[model samples]
Target: MDLPNTEAVGAIVALLLARTKRGDGMKPWVRLVVPLCIAVAWVHSPALAQQPAKDPRIGFLWSGVAEAAAVRMNAFLEGVRGALRAQGDHIELVARIADGNQARLPTLAAELVAGKVDVLFAAGPAAVRAARAASPSVPIVALDLETDPIEAGLIAGLSHPGGNLTGVFFDFPDFGAKWLQLLRDAAPKLSRLAVFWDPSTGPMQLKAVEAVAGSMDVHLSVIEVIDVGNIEEAFRTAAKQKVDGLLVLSSPIFGSSPAMIADLALRDRLPAIMLFPEFAQTGGLLAYGPNLIDLFRQSGTMTGKVLAGTAPADLPVERPARFQLIVNLRTARTLGLDIPPSLLIRADQVIE
Candidate 1:
C-alpha cells in the first residue's frame, strides 16, 4: 500500500522532462509511466523482506565410551550451549558417544552424515577422521585433535582449511616433558618411570616422553593399556617392577576410567601425572595439560559460525591457548610425598 519509491520516481520524471528540450510529438507521459512501473515492481518485490534464519542441528560425537562419559559430555554440551548463546545462535544438538569403543565410530559417523546434520562436532583425531571420511561435503568442527590435521588429510591447511574440518589442535608436544618433570619434582628419588599408554593411539606420545626420561637418567617401562580391563594390570606391573613414578598418556580408555585409574594409582602408592584437570579433581595426583572445557567452548563457537554461513574451509585450525597444572594436595599427603613449595606455587590449581 505504501508506494514510496513510486512517488519519488514521479518527482524525478517530472524534473527530467522540465529540463530537457521537447522531442517531435513525443508522449511525455510515456517516459513517466515506464519509470513508474519499474519503481512499483521494486517496491512490491519480496527481496526486501528476507526469510528468517533457522537454527542449526549439530551432530556431536565423542571418542570416549558412551556410558563412561555422561558427565564429561554434559560439561561439553554446557560449554557449547553457553558459547552459542553468546554468539546468539540457537542449535539442536544430536549427540553420540563412542563409549570407548573405537569400532563403533565409523558406523556412528556414517549415521550422523546420513542424518544430515548442519555441522559435525567431534573430539580426537580418530573421530574427526571418521566424520571427514563419512562426508567430505558436510562441515566438521573438532576439538582435541592430537594428530596433525594436515598430514592426517583432515584439512587442506591450517590457515585456510580447504576441507570441512577446523578446530583446536590438542597435541601439546611439551606435554610429555612437563608431566615427567612434575613427577620428578613430586618424587625426587624417582628412578624408574612406568609409562601407561593406549596401544591404539599413543606410540608418538611414548617416544616423546621416552626421550625426556632418557635425558633425566630415568628408566621408563612402557606399558600398554588396551582397554579399561587392562588398566589394573598395568598399575600392578608398574608396582611389581618398583617403578617410582607413573605417567599416564592421553587415551579414550584413560579418560573414560579416570576414577578407576586414580584409585589404582593410589593403591599402588605411585605418584602419577595426567593430562586434564579433571583427573586431579577425581583424586589423581597431578594433571598438566590443556583446559579441556575451554577447548570445548572453542569448538562450540566455531560450530556456530559454520551454521551462520561461514564455510569450514575459510576458518583456520587453532591450537589451545589455555593450559593448566593441577595438583591434589590430599593425594600427595596420602602417598607420603611432600609437594615442593615451588611446584605448588607454580600450579594453576591446588586442590586440598
Candidate 2:
C-alpha cells in the first residue's frame, strides 16, 4: 500500500491524542473539524496564491501613417525595448496611425485604453492630447513634439508632468530662430519666405522667426495648413506672393505628409527648410531641427521607467540633447542653388 503523508498523519494524530487527554473538556467534533481546517488552509497557502507577472502593454498613437514616420518611430520604440530587455522586462507594443487625420486620434486613444494598455506612447501633440483625454491613470510618454507641452497645457510642467504624462520636448521656440538663419545662409538672396504652420501648435511661433528674419533682411508671411490637402495651395500662395523660400514648421498636419511636401517643394523650385531630417531625406533642400531619432529614443527611456514602476509624474520631461543641420546637395544641385560655404561647413549631414 502507498504510504500515507507522514506529516499530515502525524498532525492529525497529535490533535486526536490531545483531545483524548482533555476528555470531556473539549467537544469530540473539535478533533474532526480543526484538523481538516488546518489541512485546507495549508493547501491554499500564500505561495500558491502568487502568480507570475504579465508582460506590459505599450500603445502608440501617431498623427500620420506608421510607414511615413517609421524611421523615427522605430528608433524610439526599439530604444525602449532594448532598455527593457536588459532588465528582463518584456512588453507588447501596439501602434496606431492617424494618417494625417486628427479626428481619428481620440477614438484610437480610446481603443488603446480599452484594450488595457499599461502606458500610451504618443507621437505628436495631437496624439498626446487624445491619450491624456482617454485614460487618466495610464502613463503616457509624448515623443518628438515641436510645441511646449506645459505652455500648451498638455502637462502641468516639464519637471512634474502631474497627470500620468511626461516626455521629450523638441524646444521649437528656440529652434525657430536657428531654422530661419539657416535658410538665409542657404539662400542669401532670400528676402521674403512663406511659413507653413499649424496654429493649434500654440499661438504663432512667429516671435522667434520675426526676430531672426528682421535682422537678416528677410520678410515672413504665415500660412495655416490644418489639412494636408491644402499643402499645395499653401506653397502656391507663397509662390504667388513671390516668396523666395519656404519654412515649414513641424506640426501634426505637416509632419504627416513629408513625401508630398518634399515633392511639392521640389517641383516648385522652392528652397525649403523644414523641421526634421526626414524632409531633407525625402527631397527638401534643407532641414534644421532637433535630432528627432534621439527624442524618440529618450521617449523609449521614459516608457521603460514607467514600466519599471516609476510614476510618470516623478520622471521629468527631457529635451533633445542634440540638433542636426541636414543639407541635401543633390536637391541643391537640382534646384540650381549653390550651397553656401557656411551652410556646407555647418551641416551635420549632407545627403548627396
**Full-model lDDT, candidate 2:** 0.74
Clashes of 2: 0
Pick by lDDT: which candidate is best? Answer: 2
TM-score of 1: 0.79
Alpha-carbon runs more than 4 Å astray in model 1: 1-55, 67-71, 78-90
Q: Which stretches of candidate 2 lie over 4 Å from their true place?
A: 1-52, 86-90
lDDT of 1 by residue, 1-352 (tens): 8655443222121211212234432111101111111112236656675454555667877767555444554455555555454443344566666656666678778877897889898787668778888887888998753576666677788899887778877656567788899999998988998999876663567777887888899999989876667878897888888888889998767776777778888888889988867788888899988776667777776776776678989998888887799999999999998999999999999999
Minimal lDDT window, size 10, model 2: 27-36
- Candidate 2's TM-score reads 0.79
Q: Could you estimate the TM-score for every candidate? A: 0.79, 0.79
Residue clash pairs of candidate 1 = 64-100, 65-99, 65-100, 66-99
